[model samples]
Target: MLNFQNKNFYQSLLNLSLYLFVYYYFVRVVYVYYKLAKYISLDFYRVALFVPAVIFITLAAYHYFKNIQQLKNNIYLNSFLSLFAIIVLSIIYHFIFRLDYMSDDVFSYQIKNLSYSILNALLGFYLYQQLNSNSSKKIIFVVWFFYAIMLLINLNGFALDTKGVSGVHLMLGDTFIIISIVAIFMNINHKILKIISLSAVLILAYLINSRSSFFSFLVVYLFFLYKEIGLKNLLYLFVLMFFVAFALYYFDLLRINKRMFGVFQGHSDGSLNERMEQFKYGIEAIKNNWFFGEFAGQAIVHTQGYRSGQMGAYMHNWLSYYRQFGLVFFVIFTLMFVYAGLFILKEWYLKNTPIKNMLYYLFVFEAVSLLVFRAYSFTHVWLVMVMLYSYIHDKNIKNLSEKA
Candidate 1:
């Protein structure tokens, strides 16, 4: 009999990398302890920032190569190719503009981190899709366990508590929490565990105070639960939501964080204004460089950031990428999303089952989340979507084989 429960080396590595990603998110907390050393702290970031990323990518690359015996096809090639094009263009623009300073900016400084994230996401989903039920369940559970550990640390006050990250970094880590909720709902046998798991996700989102993350989880979570358990049972859950919201407000937590919410309040906190300014700056930069936007000179982000102390100093999402990379990059990116969307739809329609149905909604929810968050900048969005589609596609192929 064929074994359906074997965990391969690559699968194990993928699971371990997921854990490391969670741990990397907490590195700033470790930095606080090291900050008191009063000695050289440069090596700390070098180790803390680069090591986890390097390990994850190295493992992921090996895993992808080792999985030749398995079935392939993760989303579409256009997505990956387009991202490659962007990276290339980003590189070319970096030099053509002759802006050496651009290489030292936050994104450039963390290019390896970005590359590692993208590579792991793409490769991880590819391997995860072909996993047998037992193996997939183990992988999901392992990933969820990491999230649970982080939550426990947060509850224990050991977490850095959002001080370590803001902007795009938080967006990257937040997706893991979203997937952890999904994993619990799917894998946990108990009903209460599922609900608590979801509630924990919302609480984490609230604690982070990311408007996009909170709203994305709220929409997807309530919608899914409403479908799963009906509205009558969700009243208590609604109460939970109310209390969480009330606590965040009553304790005046939003004041400390909160971005993109100043227009209606008759105030300018530099968050919302800065994003709008980014659009303005993008428009202005396009006219000067035309091909690569503002990769060079006084028009670049750090310059604008230094001048304005603004929030969104760079392209925020896929649409925003148009501002930096011109129309060609934007069209390629939009096409990639369309192609990925079609694949998910095809798989769901072919299967027409509950799990496949749920995946459809999940993909859509993730799409909305990435649009709100940073789509390409944060790789988890791509990772989660590709993982879901890979499973769906594999099932579709298996079904066709059985039918034939």
Candidate 2:
């Protein structure tokens, strides 16, 4: 007998399928970024992985919607739909009004952005529904473990090329480390596995010499540590870290790339310089079109060197939103996230748990990344935002039911 009504079975299936699809996005973006078409055509993965992922996701979603409660007054759903409407409207406005301003490459990037936005939103909602379960955390950790192992297997292949690029390291390392940190704190049974994953991710981050990623990881880890452990314990741990760092430095074993550490000494790398230039240009663009949006390729058109004439060469922050989507979209999205964050903090204050702490840590990570590191279009940021909002919404509903 097929137990079509079994929630546990469907939830497990959904978790496996959904994360596979999400991580496939990671791999796909890597392939595209590195131009690894000779290794495997993107179309090949689309047919082999994407098709089945979508179909399974659809089946799982059908079960979820059928079994779940009605969305008669779902504030989160309404908020998401409103934000998505703004996204669609902004895209249409750009396409219609800024047609002559955008080159072919710019148009292609916009199309990719639109498609990825929709896909990430759908994934976020599915994970939101799944995450309310007790086992979902374990399932997520297991999936991360699998991906971390795969990364270890292919570590050398993703090493810095002639370009001296560490974007892959920053992306993959930060992704795994944040999850591993949360999992380590939440799932005591999987402590060893989480430690192994975190170690691998740190190794990658160090070897690739991604300073921003290491800094981000340190900040979030310390924040969560302070929350879980008291300030006194954290200070003791800091003293221990200082000794460890001193020992490594004294042994001449801590050989971080000079360029990676140079930022602290006011010496900037080419990439840093480029980002500074983009920031300057982005600020100016914002000033010019403070109320409305600017053209898509205006950053490229205005810049003179170092990623000059590049399609997506813009600020790697929320400023990217203002430049592309205008002040209205930026304000609305920022407010949505800020409100979600505040709501989460309120809930956490009322009742803090390992799982809630993990969610807060994830929120802090994404918030930090978007402020200075990642571009506005980065899909994972949207996923994290939606996940946080979903958590808050679920908690709100639970509280209301309890009162009744």
Candidate 3:
């Protein structure tokens, strides 16, 4: 019932997922070991990722060149325009509206993540080209198996209060994305398997008290499981929620209580005030470069009447990107999703087909995620883009083959 025309495409996607998993672990392992390598001169672990990364990049590049004509079709071409404009504008504002408080750490962070964004896009494009029906099942199986092992590692680390070997130092976000991806895949059947995975993850997410992950679980519930629930189920859900709240309170680990119970509690506590300050600072920082917004990790060329350090506070709010980065870049960001949506839209709605509905709903869920999380610089966004657009590629191949 998977309903895919190209098993090879699916396999490639699974491979990409595996690729991300390996890359992240490799980078983090190297970074961690490199730190303690002073005794043994193990710098090789530091740059070991470049070996596999370079090979995959080269393989992807070859495939990209082989499909240059098809790859540059109108859809990809238009999306590139959006990508190009955004990057160019980001660089321009970074230089033109320079902040004086830019630190070396911030500058390097931005540039490194930017480079990663391009590489992810290219790798995704390459994976998309290698679509075939005979794609390996082994890759998909491997990803799932690896995810199971990683999940255990994460859980163990959480229990022990130890930094995970999942590349905490270098690619924490990627690790989260990979976990979510594999979890989602494993739960595609949406029954006992789904419940088991969700329940385990939900407990872990709550035990760790990550509000974002908790919120993500809630959103996923609404997206995938809402329709199946009834009023009677709501009663059960409330009971479950009550227990969850009690457990969190009993354990004293829930960090977002202020945000959750500010009115009843009658006072601001914990991160609520700090989060508000960051959002406020982000909005104020954008005024420095009203058009293009503040540059990433760069000092404010001239920030008057504001503490220079305040401008650099961590931005946790989803809209902080729009508030801090500028409207033009926001529009460009919006275009990325829109372009992903435009692919093949199916000449017909093709009702009653599980495949069609799944893709449609996936995009809907994706669009909704923008309001909840900002992922403009994240490779996961590119991964989703490739996943969405591959349907278009399959459609194109089918149409051409029929004519032939």
Name the top TM-score candidate.
2
- The per-residue C-alpha lDDT of model 1 at residue 22 equals 42
Please report the TM-score between candidate 1 and the true structure.
0.68
lDDT of 3 by residue, 1-404 (tens): 12434557545554653565455534353345234465544556535555656656665555556556655666644665576557666765655755566555655666666666655555444443432222322343354455444545654323312254432322332344344443344334555565565556555444333444445545555444443465577568769988997898689754444433453577755555655555566666666557766556223322355545222354554454565457776666666667656552442143323234344444543454445543344444555565565656667668988999
Which lDDT values do the candidates have, in the order given? 0.55, 0.64, 0.50
Clashing pairs in 3: 8-135, 98-301, 99-299, 99-300, 99-301, 100-299, 100-300, 101-299, 102-299
**Distance from true location, Cα of 16 in model 1, Å:** 5.7
After superposition, candidate 1 runs with Cα above 4 Å error: 1-75, 100-103, 126-176, 189-192, 230-268, 283-299, 302-312, 342-365, 373-376, 392-396, 399-403
**CA deviation > 4 Å runs, candidate 3:** 1-17, 25-42, 92-99, 126-174, 183-190, 227-270, 297-314, 317-326, 338-370, 373-379, 392-404
Compared with the true structure, what per-residue lDDT tens digits does model 2 show for residues 1-404?
Answer: 01357767666665754565445445553564456676887688667656666666577557647654665356666666676776678767776776654666776777667666655666665665665566766766675666556555554433443233435656555556555654554665353454444445566555545566666666666665566567998799779978998898789866546666777777758888878877888888789889876647333655344334456477888778788777777888899888877877776667766656666767776777778777766766666677677677667768888999
lDDT of 3: 0.50
**Backbone N/Cα/C clashes per model:** 0, 0, 9
| Ranking of candidates on lDDT, top first | 2, 1, 3
